[model samples]
Target chain A: MFFKFKNKKITNMISIVPNNIIKFEDEAGQYNFPIKRTLKMMDIMGYKEHRLFNDSVILSDVAVYGLNYMFENNIINKEDIDALLFVSNCTDHIIPPTSNIIQGKLGLKTDMICLDIMQACAGFVVGLLQSFMLLDSGSVNKVVLINGGTMKSRVSKKDRNSWPLIGESCSITVIENGGNNDVFASVYMDGVNSNALIIPAGGFRMPSSEETGKLQTLEDGNERALDHLTMEGVGVFNFVQTVVPEELKKLMDYAKIYDKDIFAYLFHQPNKFMLEKLADKMGMERSKMPSNVVENFGNSDSGTIPLVTTYNYGSLFEQEEKTVCFSGFGAGLTCASIIMNFGKLENCKLIEYGKNR
Target chain B: MREKILEILQDLRPELDFTESNDFIEDGYLDSFDMVALVSNLDKTFCISILGEDIIPENFANLEAIENIVKKYK
Candidate 1:
C-alpha cells in the first residue's frame, strides 16, 4: 500500500512527445454532440489539444529517441544502463514485451535486465519504485526507467469520454545510487474497480472480434466498441479525488515531512480541471504544484509527470535542491506517489520526436 | 450564501450560467470534476467540511441544493 526508497537519486528525466496535435474543437464535428456542449465539456475537462502518434511512431520510437538524445548529449553512458524496465499499456504487440523490443533496437547488452511492466497513468512512479528496489540489492548502480505507450491508440473515435482527453508521449528517467534515501513512495490499487477504467476486450478474457469492433451508442450518447479502452470518467474522477488527498497525508506522515517543507508537488497531470480540483482539496497553493503539463502536451499518461518535471521545474531543479512530491493515478485504477529532494540534473531534456525516427 | 457559491462556481466553469440553470448535473453542466471543485471551494468559503457521502448528485443538482448542504455546517 505504501513504500519508501532512499539512497537513490533520479539523476535525469527525458521526455518526448509526437509532433502531431489534435485540436478538440476540430474533432467535435465527428462526435455530433452539440458543439456548444462539447466546447463546454472541453473547458471543464481541461482539454484544448492533445498529441497523437504519427502512424509510424510507436511508443518505443519516442522513448528510444529520448534515450538516444541522452546518450548523444553525453547525459548518460549507454553501457552504464544495466536494467531496462519499460512500463506501458499500449505496445506494438502483446506477445513480445516492448522492453525487449526497445533493447533490441538500441542494441543493449544481452546480460542487462530487460522486461516490460504493463501499467498506465501511475506508471512513472511505479517504474521508479521498481527501479529503486532493483538497485538497492547492490547488483546494479544505475537503472533506466521508462513509462510510456501509444496510449492514444486505445482512444476510439466514437468514444467521447476518452476522445479529446487522450494525450500521448514517452518519459525515460535515470536512477542511480549513493544519494540520501530521502525519497518516499506509495502505490495503491482497487482491482474490483479496475474496470472503472479498462479495455474490456482485446485481451484473452474477451479477445477482439468483429462483434466487439462494431460501434454502438451508449446511454451517455457516446459510441464505443468493446475492443476500445473504455473509461467511466465520473468513476475515475471520484476515485482519485477521494483517495489521493488522504494518500498524500499518509505519505507526509510516514516520511515525517510537512507541507511547509515541500518546495514542489508535481502530480501526474491527468488534466487541468482534475488537477485544479485536487489542488483545492489538498489545500495546496497553485504555484507550489505544477498542473499544466496536460494542457501543454496533452494527457500523455505516464509521460505527464516527467514532462512536468522537465518542462516546468527543470530549470529550478538544475539550480538548487528542493523537497518535491509526485503523485499519479489512473488506468490501473491505481495511484502512486513519491516525496524526494530533487537535486541537480546532469541531464533533463524535453525533446520532440523528429520526423526521421 | 447562494450568491457566494455562485461566485465560486463561476470562476471554475465560466462557460455556463450557473444561476440560470437548476439542472446542473443532468444537463451535463457539472460532472465529477466540477462537483469536487465546487464542494472544495464551498468547504473553504463556508468553513464546512464536505464528506464523501455528502457528494451525492442531489446535493450538487442545483445551486439551492449546494446552499442547503452548506447551511448544515452553519
Candidate 2:
C-alpha cells in the first residue's frame, strides 16, 4: 500500500513586493573581515529609510529590522501579523525566547503566537516551510518569518578560518494568505550524517559557563571551547555532494519538472569554490547557480540564500512564467530545497529609498 | 604600475578581461569588497596606507585610474 500526500492549492500566494533590495553596508565601508565595523555598519544601515536596524550584535535585530521595514513601507499593520517565526543560530536572550523579544520590539499583538527556530543556516528554509504550512492550514493569514545571523560574534576574532568564512546579516519575508498555485513544492533532508557541522558549546549538551568560556580558543589551537563554529569541511562537502543532488532529483521527480523548467537555482551562498563545485556536480550551469556571497558577506548563516534571492530578483525572475529553486544547508547539518513559481502582479511596485549621490 | 594593477585585477577576477581603461565598479567587474581587498593588497605591495577618502569609485574605476593614484604616491 502506498500513502500519498494530497497537493493543497496555495491561494493568493506569498510574494515579495518591491523585490529590489538595499544592502546594509558597514559604517567603515569595509567588507566582512572586521566584525566590530560590520556591527556598526548594521546600525548605520538601520538609520537609513529601510525598515530594518541592527541595534545590538544580537541576532534579534533581524526581526526588529524586518518589522520596522514593513511598518515603514506600510506593508502590514503591527496588530495584523498573526504568527511570528524567528530563524537564527544566535539568540542572545535565552529565557523569554527570541521571538518574544521581536514581538516586544515590534509592539506586535500580545495574543500573537511566537516561536524560535534554531536551525543555523537552514533556519530560513525551515521557517519558510513552516510559514507555508501554517498559512495553508487556514489558521494564520499573515506570518512574519525573520532570518538573521551574527556568527561573527560567536567566533574568536583571531580564528582565521571562522573569521574569513563567517559574517552577519538579517532579512524578513512576510507570507500572507493568498489563494494561488505559485508557492509550488519543497524537499527536506532525511536523517543521515546529522553532525557534519556544529558548534560544540553553548547548547543543552555543553551549556555555556565561565569555565567553558575560559577554555574556548579563537584559533586552531588546543582550546576547543571558545564557542566557535566547527565544521568537517570535507565531511560537509561529501554530504552536500551526495544529499543535495538527491534532494534536487527527488524534488524534480515529485514536481515532475526537468532541469530546464526552472529559471534559476538559488542555493545557499556557501562560497565561490563550493558553489562552483556544486554547480559542476549537479549538472547545472554556473549562471543558473545565482550567487556565492562569501566575498562580501561571508557565509551569512541562514540569511545567505534569501540575500541572494533579494539581490538577484530582477535578473532571475524577469520572465512572466518563471520557476526558481531555493536550497539552504547549514548546521543541524540540515538542508531544505523549495521550488517556487512566479507570476505577474498588478499591485507590486519596486521602492528605491536610498541616496545615490 | 598600470601593468601591475592590471595583473592584480586579473588575479582577483580571472574571468573578466580587464584593461587599464575598464571601469571596475561601473563596468560590473568589481564589487565593494573586491575594491577594498584590492586597495589593501595594493597598499601592501607598494607600502602605502590608502586613506578612506582617497579610495573613491573614480580612482579605482579602471587600471589607468588606479595607476595614476599609485604613481602620485610613489
Candidate 3:
C-alpha cells in the first residue's frame, strides 16, 4: 500500500548498541566452513565485529538506557511523548506487551497510547509508518518509536548461518507533527513466504522443548535447532534482489524521487553482499547506499536502518536538511520504504548502551 | 546459454571452474551471496525474471539446473 503524510516529521533519533563486541575471526571456528573458506566468506560478506548484549540483558534494558539518555540529555521531555511504539522481535514477555513495560518503567504519563508491534527486519520503517499514521490522526503530537531487539537470544550460537549476523541495539525516534515536506511510504507483505525466515518454535504453534532445542546439523551444514532462528539464505537473497528494488522504484515513483535527488538510501543492512547486489540491481551507485552496518555492528534486525542513519551521517543530519529514503525488509517476508525531507535533528547520534548511562 | 551461464559464474568466482562439481552450492563452489549476484546477472543477461521461489539451492546447484530455470522463465 501507499501512504503520504504531510505533517509528520522525525525530529530526534538515537541508536544504542551494547558494549560487548564479538569479532568474526574469534567465532570463525564455530561455522561449518573450513578456515580458508570461512575467511574468504568473511571478506566477501563483510563479516567483522558485531555487538551482542549479554544473556542477562533484554531488549527493554537497552531501550530504557537509551530513553534515559534522551531524557537526561534534555534531547526530549518525557512528558511530551504522546505515544510509545516498541517494535521488536524479542519481547520481555509474550503476555504483557513490552511497550507498556517500557511506559511503566519510564514512569511516563498515563494518557499516552502504548503499543507493541511484533516485527523484525522491516520494523524501523513499519514503526515510522505507524507513528506517521498516529500523528496524521492528530491524536498524538509526538510518538516515541523504539525499534530494536536482543536478536542473539533467538539465534543459536552454533548456527553459523545466523550467529555471526546477529547484533542487538535499540533506536528511539521522536516523530511529531508540523513538518515541512510530504512523507511518502509503502509496505509490501508476503505472508505466504513468511517461513523463509522464522523461528520454528517457542510460540503456541510449536512450544519450545528439549527436543526442539536439540541441535542438529541442517542441510546447509550449519547446526541449529527448531528453537533457534533459521533463514533460507538463497530464498531471502532472491527476494531482496528481485522484489526490493521493484518496491523501492514504486515508492520513488510515487514520491517523484530520482537517483540524484536522494542524499542516501538508508536501508536495513543484512550484509555487505546483499546490499551491494541490491544497489547494483537498482542501477544506483554503491556509494549512495551504506552497507557497512552489518560488518561493523552486525544486523540488529529492525534497528539497522536507523543505526545506519546515525552511524553514517549523524553529524550531517544535525546540521542540514536532505531528501533521504529508508527501506527495511526481512522476516514476515515484509518489505517497506519511506522517503522524506529529513534532517536538522535536535539529536542524531549513536551511543553505547552502558557508556551513555 | 550454458556458455553464458558459465561466464557469469566465472566472473563471480573466477578461481573456481564451474564444471567440476555437480552441486555448486553443496560443494561450496557457490554461496548464498554468489547466488544473489549470479541471479541478478542472469536476469540482466537473459532478460528473464527468475522468481524468488525458483532461487533455491537446487535450481542453481549446477549449470544444467541454472539453465533449466532460465529456460522455464523464458
Candidate 4:
C-alpha cells in the first residue's frame, strides 16, 4: 500500500519514523478558566478580547518549548530539517501562516519548505501522514511535524457543556526514515459532521462580518460567531462514540491485529469521562488507556493525541514493546489512528521542552 | 504587602514555594497566563488596574516586585 507521485522516484527514499516525541505546556497554565481570566484582564487593559480562540499563547508556549527541547537534545538540528509541517486550526496570527513564524523562531533555514495544514483535531495524524508521504517520495529526508491548538478559550462561555471542558496544548514529533516495523496508517473524515463542531465565523465559507456576527445564536443557544467555539455536545459525543471505535476496529482488523494485541490505546484527550466511556465501549481495559492530560491542560485541539503519546511513551515503549495505537478525532468530524511497533525504546530520547518564550 | 503577594502566589500555584523575591517566570514558577491571572486578581483585590506594558517580566519577577507594583498603583 504505497502512494506514488508523478515524476517522482520512490527508490532510495528514507523511511520516516518517529524518532523523538515531545509534549509541552506552560508550567502553571490552566485551561479555560485561565484563558477567561486572561480575556478579562485584557478587557481591563482596554483591549476588547474578542475572538477568544484566535491566538493561543499557552499553545504557542508549549510548541516553542518542545521545539527548543528537541534542539537542545540534538535530535534534529535546525539546519538538518528539510521541511516543517504545522497542523493546527488555531494559529498565532491571521497572516503569514504560523509555519513561517515557527520557522523564524526556531532559527531554521529560511529556504526550508514551510507549510500549514488547517485540519481541526485530526491534524497531528494528518501531519504525520503528510510527513510520511513526503519522506517516502524522497522530497525530504527529515521533517518536523508539530500538531497543537488552543481550543479551550474558543468555546462559547454561554454553552455550559463545552465551556469548562476544552484544553490547550502543543506537541512535536520528529519523524525520520528508519529501521522500525510500525504498521502503516489510514485516515478518514465525515464531512456531514463538520458543522457539528466549528467556529461559525472567520473562514472562507463565512467570513467575519457584522451581519454574520449578529446571527450568532444557534437553536441550541450556542454562539455562531468567531467570538467563541460552538459545539453540539450531544451530537459530537454521539458521532465520536459511534465512529471512533468502529474506525479503530476497522483499522486494527486491516492490520491483522486484535484488540488484546494493542499495548496501549492513545486517543484524543477530550475529557476524562468521555475517553473512559470510549475505552469501555471498545472492550479495552481502563488500565491500557493512556492518561488524559486534559484535566489540567484542556483540549489542545491537534496537540491532544501527541501529548498523550509523549506522556505515555515510557510505559508504551517499555523494554521491547512492539505495538501501540494512536488515535485522534475532533473538529473536522475527523478520526485517525495508526498502529506503531516501536522496536527499541533505548535509542529514542524523550525530551521535556520547557516554556521560556 | 510582599507577604500578601506571596500568599496569593502560594495559593495559585501550590507547586512552587513563594519566597519574598522569587522570579516567577525564570524560576519556572509562573507563565504568561499565570502572570495575567495573577495581575487580574491583584487588580481586583487591591482595586488597581495594571497596564499591559506594566505586566512585563521585570515587574512580575518576584513577591517584592509585585508588591511594589500594587502599592505604587494603590
Positional deviation of A94 in candidate 3, in angstroms? 0.8
Model 3: per-residue Cα lDDT over A1-357, one tens digit each: 999989677899999998899999999887776655565557557789899888899889888889999999999999999999999878898989999999999999999899999999999999999998888787799999999878776788887778888888889999989767899999999999999999999999999999998998976668888999989887788889888989999999998998899999999999887787678778788899999998899998889999999999999999998999999998889999999989999989999988865
Output the worst ten-in-a-row residue range by lDDT, candidate 3 chain A: A35-44
Scored against the true structure, residue A32 in model 4 reaches a CA lDDT of 30
Provide the lDDT at B46 for model 1.
84
A1-357: candidate 4 lDDT, tens digit per residue? 212222211111111112222222222133233433334333222222111222424455556667776566554578888878879887776788788888887788876788888887788777877877777767688777777766654565454345444555566666667653545566778888788887877767777777755535554333435646777655666666777888888887777788778778777776654565577668778778864555434466777676665555644344455577777787788888877664343323333333222
Q: Which residue pairs come into collision in candidate 1?
A: A6-A181, A7-A181
| Candidate 1 per-residue lDDT over residues A277-337, each given as its tens digit | 6776788786888877655567777778888888887777777778889888987788899
In order, candidate lDDTs are 0.79, 0.60, 0.87, 0.62
Provide per-model DockQ scores.
0.20, 0.02, 0.20, 0.02
**What would the per-residue lDDT of candidate 2 be over residues A1-357, giving only the tens digit for each residue?**
011122322111111222122343422233224444334223211211122213344557544654565576666678778888887867866677888888887788887789888777777777878787777676787787777576654665444334445556666666665534455455555456666676667878898778766645422231344366666555665566676777777777776777889888877865554565467667778798865455545566787776666556633233354667778875666778777664332212222222110
On TM-score, the leading prediction is 3
Residue A317, candidate 4: how far off, in angstroms?
A: 3.4
Pairwise TM-score winner, candidates 3 and 4: 3
All candidates: TM-score of chain A: 0.96, 0.77, 0.98, 0.76
Q: Which runs in model 2 stand beyond 4 Å of their true positions?
A: A1-55, A182-192, A215-226, A314-321, A343-357, B1-74
Determine which window of 10 residues in candidate 4 chain A has minimal summed lDDT: A8-17
